[model samples]
Target: MTQTPTPATPVHWKVVIDTADPHAQADFWAAALRYVVEDNSALIGNLLGAGAVPAELVVESHGRRAWRDLVAVRHPDDPYDEASGTGRGRRLLFQRVPEPKTVKNRLHLDLHPGEGRREEELARLEDLGARVLRRVEEPSGGWIVMTDPEGNEFCLH
Candidate 1:
């Protein structure tokens, strides 16, 4: 008899980004990706009521309570924990950093908006405060590099 190996469990993860303004980054990313910003007001309220969280550590975002140093955005259709408003799938967490971004990103997001809709999507992103850095044309295909409001680099292909 031969034994079949069991598949490994998938790891859960969220991309952590350093930003000078986490709330603004969260808003920009949420709009750019058509995702929803996670709201943790209920959890914060519970913690505050229990004296488990400091009031100064929280801030009002979208008129709701959120962590002052961090914010996240998640795919609208992804499963989330109702108690904490945290996503179980694709998500991005932006954390506050004291210093500004002064160099190119070592890793960046690459967006695919479909075959021929790249230009349309690019225009929409520009309207959302993204500026085109440059356009790249290669033998394989082409893409447009862009910088977000705070200057983080990303590409549209």
Candidate 2:
């Protein structure tokens, strides 16, 4: 019998969310997902020292330097680039946008805390600044639709 060839490695990518405040969104998401906020301060400092980036394009956040227009959060267990602080695995990047979110999201996250723990997870998320939009009860199952502080929609399961 011949063995089948293994498929190519999946591309590593990150989801990007547009927001008016990237750091705030990063903080909220980091808490909600039990993830870590990416620390790009060292990279920023290096760029600034080399005159590769303008001081006006950076900001002080969490007592450290950060990009004024973007920030990212990554799964706690994911590998990251030491030189750039960029995640090599699961990640979400939030970028500054001029306009606020005016419409429903074309893509949204569905969080599953565990079996029989939706209510507790919902409460925790609410305390983290998530607002419930509605609850859905279908014959198959149920879920609660929520929005983050920036109005990006997500669901709890």
Candidate 3:
């Protein structure tokens, strides 16, 4: 007799992006996807008051205190920490880097726009500083390949 194997427990995952400017990328992506940028102001404030974080490492974002070297955005519909203002689902974390991107991304995001709104969404993203890299087609499917202002590749399917 043949038997199916038991499914493994799902593990949590987060997408990490390398960038010279994390804040800018976070802003662009947040607007493009209608996601809310995570507000760690309370945490930052506490750290600052305790002297755990240097004052120079903080910045004013959305009229609140935040870390200067990192930021994250998440789906607006997802559950978030009220005190810290961080999303619990579909989050994108941006961290600063000293060097610029010089190679193709081995991993990228594929956006399924759904139905006939691909062009419209693409246009809107372009207006938000995304550049069209190319249009690709295959026997099985097709999509518009684009890059963010910082040149990180993503697609509109």
TM-score of each: 0.95, 0.94, 0.91
Overall lDDT per candidate, in order of appearance: 0.96, 0.95, 0.90
- Which ranking of candidates, highest lDDT first? 1, 2, 3
- Cα lDDT tens digits, model 2, 58-79, are 9999999999999999999999
Residue ranges of candidate 3 with Cα displaced over 4 Å: 1-9
What is residue 2's positional error in candidate 1, in angstroms? 11
Q: Residue 105 in candidate 1 has what lDDT?
A: 99
Can you list the residue pairs that collide in candidate 3? none
Show model 1 residue runs off by greater than 4 Å. Answer: 1-6
- Model 3 root-mean-square deviation: 3.4
Q: Pick the TM-score winner.
A: 1
By lDDT, who's the top model here? 1
